[model samples]
Target: MPDRDVRPVRVRLLEAAARLLADEGPRALTTRRLASEVGASTMVVYHHFGGMPELVRAVIVEGFARLAEHMAAVPRTADPVADLGRLALAYRANARANPHLYAVMFGGVPLDGQAPPAEEPVAGRAASGAGTFGVETFAAETFGVLVEAAARAMDAGRLRRDDPEHVSAQLWSAVHGFVMLELAGQFTGGAETVLTSMLVNLGVGLGDAPDAAARSLRAALDTPAP
Candidate 1:
């Protein structure tokens, strides 16, 4: 028998497919191509994810799962607004770390049946059923993490009294927009400073007093990302 490769086949194959899709479009996701990228056999791809369709679905789900894991890992601090800030930072970091997967998760490459319109969705990958702006936030599972964080802030009288889902959508839009810009190499300033400013502005917009919002976001910026 040929010497078996011992690397994590599923992860390697999935990541390779995402990169192919992101870099070269969907047509690049051939079985042979994926195998060559991972230095594995086509058999490994079929065995691990069944077929291309299955692999595509797995890619979308895995993207959201990885994002959820990142959000979930953020330790909830006493300051809910600060916690929201941390989650926002985590969202950006996850996107930066997994640009290809992030593209697949968002509207960049439509693995799902939904066609991308002229303007791409900033709040993609929302798993939960978004109440008002249902289209934004593609993965609700991951967005739910954001909602919970924002709700904590709202409950603590940090944000305005309103729907957490809606609040999360607004916040997600800002964070996602920044990530998209950053990934596109359009950003030229300090990341933390930019993010902190955006969050502080959003905080005030969401009903936090200007001073309090600035203070909370300052704490958020000072705290380390998870």
Candidate 2:
């Protein structure tokens, strides 16, 4: 006879939830549906996450955690701008690979305006039983990776002497805007070409020498992401 799967219930629920969220939108994440997907009873969802709101929050947290892992894997080089550019590429790739999860992570449409309903005091305590931190903490920590990279670039004289937070925010906005547009089918031309142009422009705008920064970014793009 085939062996019974023995993975922990929480892990199984999370994996099933992620797949369901990706395939169907947030609305499809009913407790019954999750339980059905994972071949478990509805009590399993409650036993693990307390309720749907907590489960959805967990899914978003897991998504950001994966994104952070992808960005963290990017190798840091002497060329901070290039490194930043490569990180941007990685971000785009991650979003593409997990469009539905990405949407959930970034509060995209359908799920965009819908904030998770607050848990009742009893439910909150039950949810907190898992000892999970707030989602914003994870998100801020992930964003700090970019801010630190920007600081490194400025310190190395590769970029202009600007507030690292401001620089990081600007770069993030530009890259994120492009990714959103591309995902929405707004780009008529090659998305990669447009991305390269945008990165080059960003480097030129912030770097001490326009030519050197552009060359460095172009070279960075040529190298495969680690």
Candidate 3:
């Protein structure tokens, strides 16, 4: 397949770019440095991605793509609420697995020395107009997994009848904030405890019966994180 020729080099370049951004910040992301980091010629980056801006965009999108894979791997159970809880764990696991990519995927990776606007919209609300690099496609798709899971829970009466998208956004916000804090070392050894409680509280807030929600979340957490 044609992708066979493209995927390896592209992935290497993307990974190298993410590491450079993580280790040295945005200003350190030069073509020569990236090429040297991967022991490839600078032309490889340009050939694979065309230019720096495009490569950065690819890295962010790839981050989302990897996240989607992680969530998608979560096996669906009979209990939708439990599935949602497991998905939250999967989301955190992905972030912990690649903190560098998470930083680059979300905010915190300043773009070429440009400061983010004071009041940028959230990525879920307005990907392009959010005064940030646009990775709308993968971002939307990744968030869509949660939307579908939320809809399933709502349909099963595990949650109240509200907009699934809205509920998904709230859950995403909670997980995203927790992941960011954890990456920044804000959480102590109690990350697992805090996240479990937060998931249970989120479930209760969505109108689930407290006992059922806590039970489901605890059961889900007992399994290996997807």
Candidate 4:
């Protein structure tokens, strides 16, 4: 071999931690266990993350970054409502894809009322007139994307004219609730269908353009005489 890559080792460690967090829960995370899981020595884990708290934060940040990437990947269509729907579906899919990482990114670990380890400062404007993370906290990065999309929808006249900030927050809250409950197995109905219906109704209230695109797609499918 042309020499093994060290970077992949660190990445594997982080990926292991994220999976452990989602599958077993935060309490189960430990450097020793992580090292064993990744087939690396305990010293390697320390070298990569310094300590447990820092490692926790890195994993959480990675989780959020992945979410932001997914949100960014949602296709941009001229129709803002359709775009938002795509974004919403993407959000749920990510959570389902990485449940533990999602939990850690959201303060899933019981830290005795302390905040989960934050790897970096939230990047945005703070309410105190100081600039902060605004909504750029790695954990909630997806929420930021949703807020921005909501505002774009309003600006494009696809959604109703409302407070973008308020509507964005509300929309995020609803979607998060659905994901959380579904993860907890609280929803007996399939989460996929439920979430789609939820977003459709939410679009109606939030100002999705008339169902023209959906109608057109359906019509195209219905036309059979090739």
Model 4: colliding residue pairs: 22-100, 122-133, 123-133, 124-132, 124-133, 124-134, 159-207
Weakest lDDT window of 10 consecutive positions for candidate 4? 126-135
Question: The CA-based lDDT of model 1 is what?
Answer: 0.77
For model 1, residues 41-61, the per-residue Cα lDDT tens digits are 899888876777667766766
TM-scores, all models, native as reference: 0.83, 0.81, 0.85, 0.75
Which digits, one per residue and each the tens of the lDDT, describe model 2 over residues 34-132?
899778999988887787777777767766766787788888888888889888988887887767667676777355323555534433332234454
List RMSD in Å for every model shown.
Answer: 7.1, 4.3, 6.3, 6.9
Which candidate comes out best when scored by TM-score? 3
Candidate 1's displacement at residue 7, Å, is 4.1
Candidate 3: where is the Cα deviation over 4 Å?
1-7, 113-134
Q: List the residue pairs that clash in candidate 2.
A: none
Off by over 4 Å in 1: 1-7, 110-138
Per-model CA lDDT versus the true structure: 0.77, 0.76, 0.82, 0.67
- Local distance difference test, candidate 4: 0.67
Tens-digit lDDT track for model 3 on 1-226?
Answer: 3343344666777788888898889889999999997778999887876777667777776788788889999888889999999899899999988888888888778776533233234454322222333466667878988999899999999999999999999999999999899999998799888988999999999999999999999888887886
